[model samples]
Target chain A: MTENNYIYAPSEHPADKFRCKVPMKGTRQLFVIDGGVQGTAAPLSIKFDEGNCSDEILQVIGVRTSSGPKELSSESSFSFGQNSQGRLILCSHTFAEDPFITKEKIKISLAPNSSVDIVLMQNEHNDAEHISEFEIDIQRDASLRMVFLTLHGGKISNNIKVNLNGENASCDLNGLYIVDGKQQVRNLVSMNHKDPHCYSSQLFKGILDDASVASFSGLIHVWPDAQKTQAYQENHNLLLTKEAKVYSEPQLEIYADDVKCSHGATNGRLDENELFYLRSRGIPKKEAQLLQQQAFAYAVLDKISSEELKERMVSLTEQRLRGEFSKCKNCCKNCC
Target chain B: MLNIKDLHASIGEKEILKGINLQVKPGEIHAIMGPNGSGKSTLSSVLAGRDTYTVTSGEIEFEGKNILELSPEERSIAGIFLGFQYPIEIPGVTNVNFMRTAVNEHRKAKGLEPLNAAAFLKIMREKMEVVEMNPSFSSRGVNVGFSGGEKKRNEIFQMAMLEPKLAILDETDSGLDVDALRIVATGVNKLKRPDNATIVITHYQRLLDYIVPDIVHILYNGQIIKTAGKELALEVEKRGYDWLING
Candidate 1:
């Protein structure tokens, strides 16, 4: 058995690292874990048997660290006969000057029916790259939902690939990114439907200001046998400044004849009418803007299934928008 | 409670309120009636210290202080409230939260203690009754999804919550149905006190019928051309502004 499944460390390592010491016995036991101290690096790895544990136990994973950048990597093989569920959460972060430097990857080979919810929240400084890859093999009757919230980041790129290997599989990807002050973000998503009755949807929205830039590139491919496939993609951007830039490209390749697919992209500034409406209420221009922005970005944070993570993300978003880190005090309790 | 002497204000470089003069005593209502471009709304905006309007040469005194020198929020804290001709809609921020903030801001400036959650909610419930506003309305964002009349009522609701010394209702009667108009006027009348004053800026006399003002002033070509007792509002309503302006 792995002894490191539950361990706490101080903030001393230049880069904290942890590998699950649990042996690969593929037990059907439920595992509950908590986070460690703030300023320490921790690398986590989880493995499971493809066939036996898939039908019995539901695996849950949580990552809450104030450390520079916590790392999580998971690998699983194909398993049928049972259903499995997995969830991952990251919160309360003060990124390293170059946080998220460690490379991470999650590979899943589904059997027939399995599901996963992977949520990544970047609420610290807006200057780090979350370089990670997620590879999923969707068997028949399997599903996956990837919800990402990038409220603050200087530069980020998320590359996710999902392959529907069996019929009757589905995947949904929803993301909201708000960039300000010359920040740049790029999200690249690719999904392949290889069998019939496969479905996929993607929605990405962004708000850019102060010469910030954002890009969304989505690709959906339907194989010849993937009949009755439904695919949709949309990317919307709101540029707060003239210098801000946004680029969106949604590519769809379908060989199936009977399919429904659509993609749309919209990029613009906030509603002037809405601004005037807020200003008329005696709310100062800056406060009005902050209120509107909170509403705009909250649409994404509300989707976080974890209440704790959702609250942390909202707090981080408010701090980022208020430029709080620039005026960071030692005991920042008012950040709530 | 309020005084405007030879007020001259403009939007951009164009003059909107040109050389206007008016005065309001405590407990009295003054309604300014005019056509579309006669600066009916400009007077209210200028009095409330709206930034878009540049008061070129105007002296507005609220309780004997030069209010033109105050910022919008500062003016609000000084008991100056403008029931916007077109109230704003702020999403995600509950009406209760916004009103509580405004109330506490004013209270804090007046050297009074801030209201705790319990006291604040209690006051909000009472004010909601003044405008016949739904109890749930306070939980929704400010003015968001409110109907035309509901928006006007919400404006009055906010006024009741803030309890400002001088309230400027800028066309609060506009877009309001007869029932809404009566409710809003009742809300205004209920809040009236010998120490508080109201300036109802409207284009019609229908609102005046419900909340009779002490005086009715005709604003033409950016200035007050005529002023008379409450009966003058009906005169304008009967014969229109042409009879008063041309005569």
Candidate 2:
């Protein structure tokens, strides 16, 4: 809506544009470009330092792709790129965004033997929308691991789509979301297997309280020629308040006979038997409940690769459990 | 000392104990013998303040103070102990923590200082030796996966730690083997003092052979049909419960 002024060039290819200069703001050292490339084929390399952007640390968000590969800032609102080999690794970092504002799409095109790692973070205090559209072209013997973690935000939604283009390629999608105090969150993910011998695995975990609502819907499609493909999906939710609700759907649509696929969803409250057992031993009810909730949220938080980020997330999760989000109604997601 | 006068109790709409009267003084032991449904266990439950039973009409006094109105935990702090007929299995709550909390709670209610962790552990070790129970067992959850004999032994161990003024053993010998019964009885005997009392409830007279009672009372149809010295227990065991019920 701001005049579509993102830089788009026709001189470079997706495989040969690693050093293209992009402008940046704030106190971070990394600068990300938002425009697309139209004609040339080249690989892109991302470098972060103190000259272009400020000397402070930087995290990126919003990724897209055009005719050539694109490099994005760690905290941008939108970005897009593509490669031939379809190999990607999105490294993890912190970012800031608004919850009420609508943002652009982040697209990626992977060429043969090409890999991408996009690590975007959201630690802002305003109302903003973060929407990323990923188009993956997985070639033979190539793989992808897209790890996403929503540590903080007022309202958050992630839409991911991956296509298996070649035989014997695989993609693993893992996500963790913690919401509390009237916060609403939605996660929509879809994977399409167009060729044979491709595998896809999806796992999503969440905790909701203070009248919050969370929904996760995952879909997997296997074409007729996608024989022998193994696909598995799971979604688990924990509701701390009586008014909190979680709606999860794990779907699988296969058109081949030699494929094995399974999907499961679980939604429930804390264990009452375990609570009574602790209380009978003189442990106050509240402390026992906190310990149980912390143990329940451990598996999801452990997926984070950064030790500092993971520790922060665990502390935030505890705060969320104790209704900390209501205190920082206007601050960023990291407040909880 | 513990005293009960015209104590009547019921479970739901069904009356289980009818006008039960008894008294136990310090330095003494009393056994209540009855057939099935004769209210032997019901009396212990009522004395322990278990919510499942309603006392229709009764007056219970412990150490010259009324005790029927107190809660289960309050009664426990008042020096009343009930060794459950069927001990409950509480998972994830270790026996050591349970006993430590109980002891400190009782002590605090009595205007006494609480024991630190080290002192508490030392006291627990000394008490555990009374029942010949393994020191390592206290680290596991309360009565979780314990054998029948072990459950009975743990009950006595708890009694030893709390040092209740009036300890009630509710059918403590029902499931114990001979060796376990002797050990459990010895633990109860060792805990007794000139200023404390014990009430033993059992359906069979065999337990009385190990834990000698100063008096024996037969409960039939919710009422104590007869009262006598320790000789009554041997007489009833020789004949049967019918001798007392019929007369």
For B89-150, candidate 1 gives per-residue lDDT tens digits of 76766787676666766677778998999999998998899989889998887788899999
Q: Candidate 1 regions off by >4 Å? A: A1-86, A91-100, A107-116, A123-127, A136-145, A152-154, A162-172, A178-182, A191-211, A218-245, A248-286, A326-336
**A-chain TM-score per prediction?**
0.73, 0.66
lDDT of 1 by residue, A1-336 (tens): 123432333223333332222211332222212232223223344433333333222223233234423443333222222265655443223324444432345565555776656566555455454454667777888777767777765566777788988888888788888788877788888989899898888888787878888999999998999999989988888788899888899899989999999999988767665555444445556766776777767666667665655665677677767766522223332221
DockQ leader: 1
Best by lDDT: 1
How much lDDT does each candidate structure score?
0.71, 0.68
| Highest TM-score model number | 1
lDDT of 1 at A126: 58
